[model samples]
Target: MCTQPAQTEEHDVSTQEENLSETDTALKSIIADVLGLEAATVNEFTPETGLFGHLPELDSMAVAGLLTEMEDRLGFIIEDDDVDGEMLETYGGLLEFAHTKRVEA
Candidate 1:
């Protein structure tokens, strides 16, 4: 009889964690490039890192450009209603949004 290796819950969780980390790094790089900020600055962003009104570089005009760049780079579309303050409130919020879009795509 032939048998296949069974994946454990721990393995699934670990894989998900790794994917989240990769997504976070990719999102940070995209944000830095779109906002014309240094990659190091984006790398320093944490969950509490405020965006939108908090970042001078991320003004209203820049928001449109950033969303366009994100769609181009991340292969996802942001609906008009999806463009909201909460999604851009903090680094974690943005990352979570990106991850959700990616999964949907």
Candidate 2:
């Protein structure tokens, strides 16, 4: 019985990891598509990859379009105030934010 429970826990963790990976992939695709970037470029992004100030495609004019695309792709609603600089500062931050929204939905 103890071993069975452990196996079940492991499976759950694995499933969660898979879901996070899928979410990350989807987010990268969305960002790339919205910003007119190559999918290959977005695929190279790591947790530390800079986004807002570093990416010329992510300027003020593009933020709204990006958020709208994110909402459309992720099937989540983003409020006006939820648009913050830190949320788009790095690839990890955006992934975390998207995951949180996914969980909340």
Candidate 3:
């Protein structure tokens, strides 16, 4: 019953960029949420921070949950083969993963 006017492809691309920024922010937020960690705590999450070593909250199950949230929220599927423990090891790596998705999209 409700329809909006179509946008130009350029407009759509701009919207997608905004959405990607939102996704990055949401990724951090969801990481904190799923990890049951304070936002500030995740501010400390860097690529070399040792996700598994540093965060006791991050285990196999949590990893699965995080991946699910990412897939659901960002509209991008994370293939199992696309990542490994090393990629989740730090904030930089996580950023890299997100960047990869944007590039792939």
lDDT of each: 0.84, 0.85, 0.75
Quote each prediction's TM-score.
0.81, 0.82, 0.70
Q: Candidate 1, clashing residue pairs?
A: none
Per residue, candidate 2 scores C-alpha lDDT tens digits across 10-77 of 88678768878988999999888877889998899999999999888887878778888888988899
Alpha-carbon lDDT of model 1: 0.84
Q: Which one is best on lDDT?
A: 2
The clash numbers for all candidates, in the given order, read 0, 0, 5
Off by over 4 Å in 2: 1-11
Ranking of all predicted structures according to lDDT, beginning with the best and ending with the worst = 2, 1, 3
Tell me the deviation in Å of residue 48 in model 3.
3.6
**How well does candidate 3 score on lDDT at residue 72?**
83
As for candidate 3, its clashing pairs are: 46-90, 46-91, 47-90, 47-91, 47-92
Best by TM-score: 2
Candidate 1 C-alpha lDDT tens digits along 1-105? 223357575775687678688889888887888778899988999999999999898888888887888898788899999988999999999889887787667
Candidate 3 wrong stretches, greater than 4 Å: 1-21
